[model samples]
Target: MNRLTFELRLVLRSRLSAAALLLLLLLSVLAVWSGMREVQRQRQTIERLAPLHERDVAALAARYPDSKDAGNPAYYTFYNTWDPPSGAAFLALGLRDVAPYVLRIRALGLQAQLYEGETFNPEVALPGRFDYAFVLIYLAPLFTIALLHDLVSAERQSGRLRLLLAMPDAGRLWRRRVGLRYALLFACLAVPACVGAALSASGIAATIVVLAVTAACLAFWTGLSLLVATRQWRSVTNATVLMGAWAMLTLVLPALANVALIRAIPVNQGVDLMLAQRQAVHGAWEIPRAETMRRFVAGHPEWKHQADVPGRFHWKWYFAFHQVGDESVAGAARAYRDGLVARQAWTGRLGWLLPGVGAQAVLHRLAGTDLPAQLAYQDAIVAFHREIRHFYYSYLFNDRPFGSADFARRPAFVPHAAAGMPGGTELFALFLLAGAVFAAGVWRLGRLRMHGGE
Candidate 1:
């Protein structure tokens, strides 16, 4: 106990060690604060929109006080759909930084509405926000390298290597030093995260998973640093080598993997689908109305009996063409979504080989803020859009009067359930990679020795 206490004090007494730990702690706190603020802002925005939307709906109802046709109201009326952040969202923010959380859609061509207002850039999501995941996955390892890179070299430079190695039970001494550093690093990260989790009501199980991942990541870096630190090299050389490895593992390789995944998957169908739907809708104006109605009725056979259009212009005919436009690009839209899911699956597979990527995958997934979460939100929107079409269709098909009373019966949007925990395969891959690296590091530490010349 006395020796362990002395080692702890010794580690903290070093200027570099003290500064690194302090900086990590501060960054962790800042990250948590920033994430919480962002999430709160999103919630406030969602809440703020409700009254504004209600006002818009009320005005629309006033405009069409006793209208019989549902066409103009359905076309003009916009419904808002939102995906609220999960309890653990503040920990990772994930795609929420770049993607839309709240969107407004009407009973129009569903595909265009889905992709509208999206200014998506793949690069934006690359350099992530300064959230806890960022601090833990990228910066924390650098700090680990700083503290452990010179663990052995500094003692040798100070001419204590020979004496220290000669001491009885020296292995225990080395273990104590490494273990203390690891614990300090872990605490610096986990303390702020736990507090943030509690504040967010992120749930006990989620907090444990996050802390576990934190420990695993720190252990991995500590082990890797130990491997390099145990070598008969100068402190400068050890730091250089570890920094290079960090760059490759965290930055270069992951970026390359992303490029490869994109090329392999080729998800260029998003733009194609959008354009196709627009063309289909526009082309309907030139084509015979009978052709459009036929296409719509073929898909919606339930409305076949009311498909006849006696007049030159009817709301039923107008809506039917729009529905037909959405159906025109349904296959392409499905392909586009499938492509995105495939890319996400490939990313998960890549996580198995890259600890930085693996840790990120686990954190964002657990927080329900990844690509899959975005896709799930879109799916919910799609479902709601279908409900919207059918609701208006009933009024149009039966030729029933749609008035202020009918406006009250419009379907409200329900946000999808929060993304579930990370898959077993993902968690297993992360732990397996971290554990292997940590074990190798411990094994190398065990074999560490000082030559007589040194």
Candidate 2:
């Protein structure tokens, strides 16, 4: 017990170790605050839109006080749909930083509106937000390297390493030293995160899962540092080699994997679907009215009996053409969505080999801030759009007069429930990888022996 206490005091007394821990704690706090602020902003935006959307609808209702057509209301009134952040979202903003959390869609071709208002540079989103996950995955390892890189090299340089190694309890001493540093680093990162999780009301299970991931990440770094630091090399050389390894794991490999996934998956179908849907909608103007209605009836056989349009222009016929346009590119839309899912799957698979990527995937999945989460939100929007079209179709197909009261009856958007806990596959993989590396490092340290120069 005294030995452990002495080692802890020694680590804290080192200015470098103390400063690194302090900086990491400060960064973690800032990241948590930034993430919470962003989440609040998104919620406020969603809430603000409700009243504004109501105001627009109310004004439109006043314009159509005497009008009986449901087409105008369906065409002009846009319903608000939003995906609220999960309680754990502040830990890792994930794809939410780039994807639209709120959207407004009318009863028009959905493919176009689904991807609209969602513009971001692929490069800009690659680095990710300054959330707790970023701090944990990217910054923590550097600090670990700073503290552990000179563990033995500094003693060797000062001509005490040989004497220390000859000590009867040298192994215990090294273990105590390394263990103390690891605990300190873990505390610096975990304390702020736990506080933030409590404030955000991130469920107990989620908080525990995140903390477990944090431990695995730190273990991996500590292990890697030990593996390198045990070698017979100068402190400067150890620092340089560890920094290079850091770049390889955190930056180079992930970027290369991203490129490979992009080339392999090829999700250009998003733009293709949008253009195809728009072209189909525009081409409807040149096609015969009967032809458009005929195509629409084929898909919606329930409305076949009332498909007749005697006039040159009817609300039913106009809506039928739009519906037909959406159907025209349904194949392309499916392909686009499938491609995105494939990409996300491949990224998850890569997490097995990359600790940084694994930590990120786990955090984002828990926070409901991954590509899969975005895809799920889009699926919800599609379902809601179907409801919207059917509600208006009731009035159009039956020729029922739409009134101000009927506007209130229009379908309201119900967001899907916040994302539930994700699978533990990635977490387990991270544990295995970090555990293996850390074990290897420990083994190497135990095998350390003095050479002539030592």
Query: Could you say which candidate leads in lDDT?
Result: 1
lDDT by residue (tens digit), candidate 2, 158-254:
8988898899998887888888999999898889889989998998999999899999999999999998998888899999999999999999999
lDDT of 2 at 127: 70
lDDT of each: 0.89, 0.88
lDDT over C-alpha atoms for residue 437 of model 1: 88
Q: Give all TM-scores, in the order shown.
A: 0.97, 0.97
- Could you tell me the TM-score of candidate 2? 0.97
- C-alpha RMSD between model 2 and the true structure: 1.6
